[model samples]
Target chain A: MASRLRSTYVLPLLKQRMEMCTEAPYLKLKHAFKDRCVWEGTVEPSGLSERYVVRITYRLGYDPQVRVLNPPLVRRADRPIPHFNGDGTLCLYPVDSGEWTAADSIAYTIVPWISDWLFHYEVWMATGVWHGDEPKPT
Target chain B: MLHVVLLWPTISGMFLIMCAATIRTGMGEDAMASQPTTEVSLDLILRGICERLQISQTQHDLAEERYHAVGKWLDAEEVPRLLKTQVYAQGSFRIGTTVKPVQRNEYDLDLVCEFNLQKDTIENPVILLNLIEARLRQNALYADKLERKNRCIRIIYANEFHLDILPACPDPQTGPECVVVPDREAREWKASNPKGYAAWFLSRDTRPSVFGLARVEPLPDQETVDEKGILKRVVQLLKRWRDLRYCKDPDNAPISIVLTTLAAQHFVYQNSEAAALTAVLDGVLASIPPFGRLVVRNPMNGKEDLSERWDDAAVYSAFVSGVRNLHTQWHALVQRKGIPNITAALEALFGEQPTRVVAEEIGQRIQRARSSGVLGVQKQTGTLTVATAPAATITPVRPHTFHGK
Candidate 1:
C-alpha cells in the first residue's frame, strides 16, 4: 500500500527528501525539511532554523493524520501553534471538505500545504490571525 | 370674571396636551430601545465556551467505538462465563458532562463491569478482580492493553483514549441496587451506587432531556443530544478551569467527582448559562468553610466523601483558592463589556489556544455579519449596532403608564 500510494501519487513530491515506512494498519510517510522562518532560540542552540520531520499516517478508510513529529523547539507562547491541535496533528483543511482524495499526491498537496501552514502559523503567532485561505477544521 | 375663566381654560388645555406628548415620547423610546447596546449576548459567549469545551461528535464516536470493542471482547468465548457480565459506562461519560481533556487529547472513560453474582459467593475482592482480569487477558486484542489498577482494569487504546473498567458485584446489604467494587490497595470491597448516583444527577432540573436516563445505550444522535445546557456547560467550564489551574501538579487537582457533585448540588435552575454558572459557583464557594477541611460528600451516600483526597489543608486550600479565582474570572468575563475582556478572562481560565479558537470563531461571525450588512459600527460614537431594513410603518405603540402613575 505504501509503495502503491508513493509511486502513483506522491513519487514526484518525495523525490530524495521524503521516505516511506509502513506501520501495520497504516502507512507512514515521513519527510525531513527545514523552515527558516521558524526561529530556534538560544535554548535550542540550533540557530534560527532547524530540521523538522513531518509524518503523515494514511489508512484506507480514515483521513490521513499529519503531524510534525519534531515540531519547532520554540513554540508560540510555549503552546502548540493555532494550526495544530493538542495532539500536534497539523489540521491542513476541513477533513470533510473533500478537498483531498486518494488520487491527490500527498507529497505535492499535503506536504506543501503543511509547509504553507507552518509559514502562516509563524505569522499567526505574531498577529493572532490565520491568513491562510483554508477553512479551519471544526 | 370673563378674563379669569378664559385664562384657566387655556392653561388646563395646554397642560393636558403637554402630558399627552410626554407619554407618546416615552412609548416611542420603549419601542425603539428593544435592542440593547450590548448586542453580544451572554448566550453567544456561553455557546462559544460550550463549543470549545464540550467533547466533539468525533470524540463521542471514538468513545462509543471503544465501548463496543470492549463489550465484544468481554462477550468472547475464551472467557469462562461464571456469571452474566454486563459492561456499561459510568461517571461523566454516562452523565453527559464529559469535557475535552485539557492537557492531552485522550479521554478518560469510566466503565463499570457488573457481574450478576452475589458478594457472599465471591467472598474476597481479589478473586473478583482476578476473574475479570483473566477473562480480559484471554482476548488477544486486550491482552497487550490490559492493566490492573487498584480497583479497575485500565485498557489503554493506542494514544486515543483509555477505558477504566471497574468490576463490581451486588452488595449483600444493599440488595441488587447497590454494588461493591474491589479496592486492591485496601483489600476490601468499596460500596458504590453508580446507577443510583447517575439517576440522582439526571434528576436535577438542569439535566438535558437528551441524556434521558439511558444506562449504556449509544447516545442519541448528536443532533438530538443537546449537551449545551447550562448545567453541563458550567461543569465543562469548571473542569477546564481545574485542568488549567492544575496543569503542573495534577495529582493535587480536585477530582471531577468532587467538582461535579458540588456544582450539581449548588446548581439553581436558571435560563441563562451565565446565570446558572454564577449561581453554581457562588453555592460551591459558600459551601467551603474558612476554618476546616472542605467536605464534598456524595449526594447519594454521605459516608463516601468525594473530597476525601482533599483532607490535606494545602490541597483543600488550593482548590478553594482556584474556585474563587475561577469565580472572579467568570465575573470579569460576564460583568465586563467588550470582546477583549471576555477573551482575556477566557484565556486566563482555559489557556491561550482554546481562547484564540473561540476568539477567531467570534471574529468570523462578526466578519460574516459585516459582509452580509447585518452588523454595523457607529463611526462617531464607536458603538456596535445591528442593521435592519427600515420598517414600513413605525413600531406600533401600546399605552403604558409611567410607574403606575
Candidate 2:
C-alpha cells in the first residue's frame, strides 16, 4: 500500500475513530504487554469458557508517512485497535506463539477496518450468542 | 496504515461506501479488508494482475461445487457403511482459505475436511481417510485429488483445495506450539495481525499457517518434517508472545499454542510498553474476541524503540524469549530418531506421558504418511522415503537447511 495514500486517508480515518472516553484499552494492551511492561491479573472467567468480553482503549502513535522497509516500529493506528484488556483480569489464557505469515498480518490492517466477518464473532462469544452450534470437533 | 485511537465512525462511513462499491467490485476489496471472504485456488504462485487478484473469490464457489459433487459421486458406488459414516464424521468436507492467487495455473482444490483428532474415535480418522481416497478417485471433479499411502489417503484436487486428511488434535502435546484453531478463528486472526511476526511469515516464505482440522492428527504428514519445522518455529514465536500478553504461565495453558487471541495480545504488547502491553491487551479486550506474526527487531535497537516504555518492553521481550527458548530446545529434541514423533516430543517437551493409543495412532500416521509420501519416514537404517505419494504438491524441506537449534 502506498504510505502517502495511507497517510492522506488512513490517518485521518483513525484520528476520527477516537472518542473522548479514556477507558478504552488501546493504551492498556500496550501497557500490559510491551516488551518491557510486566503486570499480572488473573482471568476471572477464562475466555475459553463463555462469559468473557474483551475491552479496548486507544492512545495511538502517528505515522511518519515514511516508506519504511523494516522501520523500527512500523505499526499503524488504523491497524486493528489493540485492547489493553488485561486490566482487571491479568492472566490471559491461550498465549500466542509468534509464528505467522505476511498475508496473515494483513488482518492487522483489516482489523483497523473492523468489519463483521471477524469481530461479530467476538461479540457473540462475549454475549454468548451463536456459540453452541453442535459440539465441534476439538 | 493510520494510527487512530478510535476509527469506528470513519470506519463505518468508509466501510459503508466500500460495501456499496464491493457489491459492484466483485471480490469485496473492502470486504476482504473488513470481513473478507477470500477464496483460495490451486496455483501456488500469484502474479500481479487485477484479474489474478480476484481468484480467491472464485475458488470458494468452485470448491463448494466440487465437494457436493464428490459426495454424490461417492454415494453412487456401494462402499462400506463405515466409510460413509466416517467421511463426514465430525464435519463435512469444505473448501479452506485460498493461498496467494496466481494469475495462471493457480493452486487448485485447496480444500479441507474438519475432523477432531484429539477428541474423535481412534479408528475413525484412520478408516475415514482411506475410504475417502478410494471414494474420490471415482469422481471426475475430485478423482485427481486422491492418492494412496499404504492405508492413508492424500487428496490433490484438480481445482482448488489440495487437501491432506488428518485429525483435528488441538492437544498441545505435539508441541505446545501446535495449537488447535478453528477455521473461522484462523481466518479472522490472519486478517487481524498483518505485519507482526506471523504476518511476516506470510510474506517471508511459503508457510501453510496450519492444516485444516483434518490433517492435524491421526496421520501426522511425515513428509512434513519440513512443514513440521516451520510449524514448530511459528508455534514458538506465537507462543512466546502469548505468554507476554496473558502473564499466564505457558506451561499452564498449553492450549494457547493454538489460540489466536493470545497472538493478538502479544502483537500489541510487543509493540508498546507503558500502554504498550496494557494498550495491546486493551485492544485485545476491545476486539472482544479472536483467534490469532513475526518480524525480527534487534534487541538493542528494539529496546531503544521502546525506550519510553523500556520496563514493559523488557518484560514482554523476556516472556517472548522464554517461549522461543523452550520451543527451540524442544524442536531439537523431537527430531532425534526415537523422539521425533508427536507423542515422544510431547513427553520430552511437556513431560506428559502420552497414552499408548496416542503413540500408536501417531505411529500409524507416520507410516501412512511415509507410504503415501506426505511424510518421509526415516528408517532405522537412516534412509528416509516419503509415503504421502506424489499425488499432492507437498514439498520436502531439506534437513541441511534446518538450523535445528
Candidate 3:
C-alpha cells in the first residue's frame, strides 16, 4: 500500500533496503510525492514517541529538502550543539553541496539519516560532544 | 602495705593498655589531636553530599507546575460541578526526603486527587475510576497521555515525569476528612491517609540540628527548603545508597516508605549527622532478624504494613546485606581521618559522580584560600597550616628565671 503512493524510482530502492533493516515495521510512507511525501515512523530502543517523533515531510521541487513535523526538536542547554534549524527541519548535511538528490531513496537515505541524528543527539546530551561525521553549520 | 604496692603496678599497667587501645582505634587523643587544615570540615562535606543527593530545584518546580496544570485542566465546564476537587502530594516529595532517581532522567510524583463527594452518591469503585477517566479525557491535553492503572491514572509526560493521580472519595466511616481510593485490581476501595502519614513523619523529626547550621537558602522562585535535622539527612543518604545499589532491579529493591518508616521508628536524636546516620543504621540492622520474617508497620496507621513489598526472601536478604556493607564502610569513614578515605567511602556508598563533584568543590575552596595567602605550607613537612605574620626582625633580650618555691 505504501509502495503504491511513493515514486516508482524511490519505492523499489526503499523496498530493497527495508528488507535488510529491522525498523521497517515501525515506518510508513503516506501521500508520497504528489503534494507532499510524509514519512511516519517510530524511533526505537529509546522508544519514547514524544521525545523523538519521526514524522518527516519531503517536497519535490528544484531544491529538495526534508522537514521534521509533529514534535519540534529544540536545542538543550546541556547539548549546546547546532544540528537543527529554527524551523523543525534537521540540517542533516550541507544543502549547497547537493548531499541529497532526487535520485536517492527517501526511505533508504532520509530515514536512516534521521535515526543517526537522533543517536548522536542523545550522545551529545550526555557528553556535550557530537561524535557524528556530519559537518556542523558554522 | 606490701599487698597494696604489688596491686598498684598491675592497675597502672591495665590503665596504660586501655589508653593504648583507645589511641589504636583512633577514638581518643590521636583522633582529636590532628585537626583539619582545610576550611572543608567533615560537616561541610556531609552537607555537600546531602546537597548532591537532593532533587534539583528545577525538578521540584516542574513537578509542581504539572500538578497544578492537571488541577486547572480538571475544572472545566464539561466536567461535573457538583464536587470540589483538591490535589495533595504524598511520599518522598511530601516528606522532603526525595533523592534523585538513580537510573532515569525523570522523577516519579505520587499525587492524590481528592473529590468532596459522599460515598452514597458514588457507590462503586469502578464508577469513581471511570468518572475520573472521563473528566481527564475531556481535556485534550490529557486525552492521549492518560493511562489507567491498578490504583491511579498515570499521566506520562514522556521524558519529563509522570504523575500518578489516585482518585478518592470521602470515606463515610472515617468521617469527612479521610478518603477511600480504589484498588482497581481488587475492585475495592482501600483506606489511606497520606496527609496523616505526612503529619506523623513531620512530628517524628524532633531531632535538634546537630551543626546548628542555617538551612541552605533556596534560589529565587524555588521551593522553600524543609527544616532538616540529622534524621532527615540520614534517611536521604540511606535512600541514595538503596537507589545506587539496586538500580538494576529497582522493583525488587526495598521501597522508600519501608526504609523511612523503619529508620524513623529506630531513630534517636544525636549530636551529629554522622552519629545519627550510624545510630539509625545500627538500629535498622539490629532489628532485622537473621532467621525469621521482617515486619515494618506504618507508625501513623496500624492497619497498613510497610514491609508488604519485601515478599521475596532473596531480595530482602540482598537489601539487608547491602545495608550492612554500607554500615561497615561508613564506620571506616568515621574512623579514618583523610579526604581520600572519606571520598572513597562516599563513592562506594553514593557512586562516582556525586563524590567527584564534592571533591572538586572542596578543591576549588582550597585553591581560593591558597591564592589569597590565607593558607600556608610548612616547608619541612609539606603540611598545610594557617598563614601568620613573621616575628619582629629585632629580637628583644629577656631575663632568665630560676625555679624556686
Candidate 4:
C-alpha cells in the first residue's frame, strides 16, 4: 500500500521531465516576471509517467499555454478554475432579476474578453497587485 | 413684465385650455382628459413653464409646439410612447481632433427603438432590427433587398444612416463584466441562478493582478457581510470601461487599447510606468466589436487559436500603438468637445489628476508628460518621443440635421 501510494505520487518526478524545455531559463523567468508566467516555458513534453502539474504564471499579450507539471489531472476540467474562489469573482451576467442565463448572444464581447485575457492576459498569471487606480491611502 | 404672476398663470392656463378644447374637438374630449399631463406632478410641469420663458425668435414661433412635443414624451408614460416613436439617429459615435472640411460630420449614429427589446426596461437591440427590416420592405424604391442579420440587426433607411440597432442586455447584475451579448447562451444559463452565477463568476477566488489597476471583483459580503462591495465592484468595472472608451483607436490598435490607455493614465499619475504597463496588460483579453469579426489573438502559439483572428506582429504593434494613442487622442478630442478643462475630466474619472501632465493634454491639464524619456528614466531619451501619429484629421461632422431637410 505504501509503495502504491509512492508510485502514484512520486512516479512523475521519477519520469525524468521527458520534455524539450530547459529548466534553467524557466527558473530564471519564473523569478523575473515575479513567477507569473503561464506557459511556464516552451514545454513540448509527452509520455511522462503521468501529466505534470506545475504552477501556471500567466502573461499578458500572449497565448494561453498551460504548464503541465503533473496530473490525474489533480484538478479536472469543466470543474471550476482550481484557484478561483467566489470571493474574487468578476464575470458580468444578465441584469435580470433571477438566474443568469447561458445564452450565446453575448459571446462576441465576452469571449473576446476572455480570449484576449487568455491570449493576451493569461488568467493564471497572478502577481498579486491591482493595476488600476489604487485607492489613495488617506 | 405686466405684473402677471397670478395673471400670468391665468393667461397660460387659458391658452392651454383653448388648445385642449381644440384638440378635443378635433380628436375627442375623452382622449384629452385621460392623458398623463393631468397626473404629472409640479416638477415636470416646470418644463412647460420654462419653455414659455425661452424668449427667442425661434421659440416665439415654435415654443408651444416644442413644449407639446417634448412635454408629451417627458410627461407621458415612458415605455409605450417610446415604442411608437421612431429612432432618428445615434449621435457622435466617434471623436477625433484632426481638422478637415468634413470632420464635423465624421461620426455615426444608430437609430433604435429607445427600448427595442420586446419587454426590456433597457434597450433591446433585436426588436429594433425587426422594425427596421419591416420598414425597409414596406417602403418603395429598392435595389438589392435589405438583408436582416440577427447579430448586426441593421435596416437601410433613405440610403443614408443604416439604422444599426445594437442589442445590449442589462442584467440585474450591472457592471462591465457579466454583460450578455447576442450569443452568450445566457437565457439557458441564467435560469439556474443569474445572481448566483454573476456573483460567483466574479468572486474573489479569481485573484488580483501584478499592478494595482486591475482586479477581479472581490468576494460577496455575505461572506464579509458587505453588500456595498458588490456595488463598488460594478462601479469599478463601469469606470474601467468608460475610461477605455474615452477615445477611439487611431491607427494600429492594441489588444485592450482602452484598458491599456486607462491603465497608463492610472499609473502615469502615480509616477510608476512599470505598474502602468502591467495593469494595462492584466485581465485584458482581445476585444471584438459587436459588428465585426474577432481580431484579438493568442500570444502563445503566436497564431490563431480558437477564432477566425490571425496573430501577426503588425497586429501586435497596432495594438500597442492603439493603446498609447488612446491617451493622445482623448487629450485632443475632449479639448474640442469643450471640456477644455482636462483637470476636471481627470478628476471626475481618476479622482485625483496627476500633477505631471502627459504630453498629450490638449485639454488644460497643468503639467504634460515629458516627451523625452522612458517611463522610469527622468532623464530625456532623445529617441523616446511620442510617435508622430497621423495628426487627427478632424473632418466636418455632418450634423444630423432634421430629417428630410
Candidate 5:
C-alpha cells in the first residue's frame, strides 16, 4: 500500500524559474518535473564572441552531464580535444574530486562551469595550451 | 622611436595611477588587467587593435634613420643651394597617430624641407619644387627611389615606408616658424604652418608632449596597456575606420587632418578610449552643418580651410555618407555583448585580420588568468571574471583538471 501510494503521488512541476536562469534569459530549463531535468542555452564567453549552445542534464543523486550541442567540437590539426571524454561530453571536473556535488545547484555551478569550459576551449584552440586545471587520470 | 622612449616614464606613472584607482575601488589588480571590459574601462580587444595598428619600435627607428640621412645630405655644406635646409616630420607621424595603411605595409611619412631662401625670391612655386627635385637627383640612391608628385618628392623605401618631402620657404609676411608651400596644380604659394599646427595640437592634447626626448631607452617587447591617452587612441581608431571605408576608393576619402581636427576640437576627456571615441563621434555628427557645406578651418591658420578638397560635390557627398555609415555601425557595436559578436562588429568597423589577431591575444590572456586561479563568475550572468578578490555577488571558480577518458 505504501509503494502504491508513492507511485500515485505526482511530482510537483517547478513553478518558479531558477534565479540564475532568469538572469541569463538565453538559457531555459525543461522537463522540470521529470527525474532528469535538462537546461540548454547559448553561452558567449566574451564580448563579440562565438555563440555556443551548451546543454546540461541532471538527475537526483547523479552527476550532471554537460555537452556542447552546436558547432560540433573538433580537433585542430595534430591536436586532440582537451578536457573531453571519448563520447564528446565535456569532462568539466573530476567527479570523484568533490569539487562539485549533487547538493550544488545546477543553475549556480554547472551552467557557469559550462561557460568557463567553453572559454578555456577557445583559448586552447587559439594556443595549444589546456589552461583548465585537471589531475592526471589513473 | 624616441617619442616612445621619452613617453615610457609618463606611461609608467599613468599605470601606477590606474593601479591606485583599482585598489581604492577594492578590485583585484590582476582581474582588472585580465578581463577586457568593466563599467568605465576600454575593452581590451579595442585597446589591442590600437596597439597592433601602431608602428613597431624597429620600424620607427628605420623611418627616423632614412629621414635623418636625407636631411643631413640636403643640409651638407657641399650643396650651395640647399644650405641650412631644415627637415622635420609633419602630419600623423609628428602627431603620433599614424595608422598603418590597410592596403599595404608601407607608411606614408610627410616631411617638410624648409629652405633658408626667402619665399619672395622665388617667382614661381614650381621653381622651388624643381630646385629640390634637382638637388635630390644628385644622389643616385635618392634619384632611383624618387617619384615626382605635384607638390612633393616621394622617396620610396620599397617594403618599409615612403617619405613625401614638400619643399617650402619661410613666409616673410607671417611668423618665421610658418612657411609658404607650393601648390603644383594651382601654380601658387599656399600659406601653411605645420610647426604652429603641431604646437596647437600638443597644447590641446592632455598628455605630455612627445617632443624633445634627450634620453632614449629601448622599448619593451610587450606594449604596456596604458601607452596611449584617450585623444590619440580615438584618432587612430577613427583613421582606421576611415581606411577600412575608403581603401578601395581612396580619392574620395576625407583627409586625416580634417578628421584629426574634428576629434581634437570636440574631445572631452573620458576614462576609456571607447567612451571618448563615442563622445567624439557625437560631437563630429553635431558639428556637421545641416544646410550648407562643412568647413574645417585649420586651427593655426584660420585663412586655410582643411576641408578645401571637399569643395568637390562628389568628395563631400562620399565623406558625409561614409561618416553616417560609421556612426550607424559604431552604435550597433556598442549594443553587442559577447566576444564573438564584438569581434565581428569590430572587424566590420576596422578590418578582419587585425580584429582577429587581437581577439586571439585576448583569449590567451584570459586563459592564463584562468590557469592562475584568478577566474570568477557572476552568479546571475555566466560572465567570467579574472578577479582574485571577488565581491559577494561573484563565485570564484575552483581549480580542476579536465581529465579525458
Candidate 6:
C-alpha cells in the first residue's frame, strides 16, 4: 500500500507551487491548521465574462472540496448543474477512477479544476448540455 | 530565524523531493493541470455565425442544376427572335452575398435573358417582354411555373428558389454589357447593366493582396464559405439583420442591392470582419441622404438611382429608422463583453436560433480540446488553453471525465 503523504510535507509544497503561478496571483492560503487548509480566489474563465469567486477546502485524508462562492450557480429549467455533489461542491473528477490521489497537489489540481468547472458551467448554460468528460458506466 | 538555521539540512532534503515531484509531473504522460487562456475574439464568433448562415453545398448544387436547365430551355431556339438570347444570373446570387431566408426556404433569384435584337429593332418594350413570356409558356413545365410580374417573367420551382427572368435587348449606346429591359408601368425600355454591375461588384469584392492571389469567381451558387471576402460577409450580416427587423414589414424594407452597394463602396480593407462591418455601418449611416435626395446611384450605369424607391417620404423615413435601429443594436453588440451578453446581443441582432447554434458549436470545440489532454490553464488567470508544448511552470491537465451526481 502507498503511504499517505504527511501534511507538513504537503502544505509547504502547496504554498510554493501557488506562489510560482503568476496567472492565479489572487489565490492565497487563507487558513491552515493541523492537517487542513483552505484557499480563496477569483477566476474568470476565457470566453466567459463573469468572474467567479471560488473557495477550496482540503483535509489530508478527505476529498478536496471546491465551491463557487459568488454568483450562485443556478439550475437550468430542464436540468440541474451536471457533476455536482448533493451538498453543492463540484465533482471535478471521478473518485473511484484513481485520477486524483492524496499525493496530488491541490494548487495544481483543485484550483485549476474550479476554473475548468466554471468554463463548462457557462457552456452548459448556453447549450443545456454537459460538455465535460463523464465517466463510463461499468 | 533560529528554526530556519536548525532545519536547513532537512528542508533541503524536502526541496530535493519537491524537485523530484516536479520532474515526475513533467515526465508523466497525463500531467493534466492548468491551461493558458484561449483568446476568444469577436472575429471568431462572427465568422462562426456566417458559417451557419451560408447556404449548404447540397442547396448550392441544386440551385446550380436548376439554373443550367432553365438557361438551356430558354436558349433551345423555341422562339425565333431569341435564337441568340443568353440567360445569366444577377444580384446576390452572382455576387455570393446571398443570405438564407430567416423564415422561408424559397430564394429569389434574378436572371436576365438578352435577345439578339437591338434596342431600335423592337418597336415596343412590351413586344420583347411578351415574346419571352410566350416562349416560356410553350413548355408545359415552365407554363405552370410562370408568374408574370410588371418587369420580369417569374418561374416558381415550388420549395426551391424561383427565377425572375427579365427580357432585354442589347443597349450598345450605353455599353456592351448594358441592356434595355421593358418596364410595363412606364411603357419604356429602362437601360440597366446587371452584367456590368456584377463585374463591378466582383472587382470591389476582390480579396486584398495580404490574403494572397485574387479569387477566381466560382460557378453560380457554389461559393465556398472561406472564400467569402470581408465585404461579402458584411453584406450578408446586414441582410440578415434587415430580414429579421423587417419580418412583418418586408415591403418597406430597404432592398439588398442598396445595402450591398453601400457596403462595397465604404469597404476599407480590414483584417477583422467585425472591424469591416463597423466601418461599413458607419459609412452607411453617414451616407443616408435626407428625404427626396437620391445619392445612391448604380456603380455601373450612373443614370440609374438604386435609391429611387426611397422617393416616397414614408419609405425613406422607414428605411432610415430601420437602419438607425440596426446601427444602435450593432453598437450595443460590440460593447458587450461576456459570451452570454455577447450572445444575447447577437440574438437581438441576428435572431436567437442561429446565435445559439453557433455558440454551442464553439463550446463543443473547446470541450474537444480539453478531452484531448492538450488543455492547459494559465497559472495567473486560471483559464484554458491548448498545451502545445508542456512547460514546467504551466502544467497540462490530466485526462478525466467529469462525473458524479
Model 6 interface CAPRI class: acceptable
**Top-scoring candidate (lDDT):** 6
What ranking emerges by TM-score with the best candidate at the front?
A: 6, 5, 1, 3, 2, 4
Question: Which lDDT tens digits does candidate 1 get at residues A42-133?
Answer: 11100111234555665533445666656442455655456565565666655544455444434324443444444344335533665445
Q: Native-contact fraction for each model?
A: 0.01, 0.00, 0.00, 0.00, 0.41, 0.56
Model 2 chain B — which ten-residue stretch has the worst lDDT? B39-48
lDDT score, residue B254, model 4? Answer: 28
Candidate 5 docking band: acceptable
Which candidate would rank higher by TM-score, 1 or 3?
1
At residue A95, give the lDDT of candidate 4: 23
Off by over 4 Å in 5: A1-61, A65-91, A94-112, A118-138, B1-42, B81-83, B172-176, B207-225, B379-382, B388-393, B402-405
How many backbone clashes can be found in candidate 6? 22
| Candidate ordering by lDDT (highest first) | 6, 5, 3, 1, 2, 4
TM-score of chain A of 5: 0.79
Q: Put down candidate 3 lDDT per residue, B123-201, tens digits, no spaces.
A: 5777666767888887888899999888888888887788888888776476435567776473776666677777778
Please give the CA lDDT of all the candidate structures: 0.56, 0.27, 0.57, 0.25, 0.68, 0.70
Tens digits of per-residue lDDT, candidate 2, B1-405, equal 101111111132343333222111111123222211111110000111111122244454555565555545554547554333212211111211122222234343322232334423443334445545666666575565566543235566544454444323233342332322222222210011111324333332344332211233322222232232232333333333343334444333323312332333334312111122233333433443222122222121221121122134444454345545544544453232221232243333333222233333333433343233233211111112222221111111111100000
Model 4 local distance difference test score: 0.25
lDDT of 5 by residue, B283-385 (tens): 8888778877789977877766889998898999999998888887887777765445566778888888777776666555555556665555554556665
Q: What TM-score would chain B receive for each of the candidates shown?
A: 0.77, 0.29, 0.75, 0.26, 0.83, 0.83
Best candidate (score: TM-score): 6
**lDDT measured at residue B48 in model 2 versus the true structure, 0 to 100:** 11
TM-score of 3: 0.58
Candidate 1 vs candidate 5: the lDDT winner is 5
Candidate 2's docking class is: incorrect
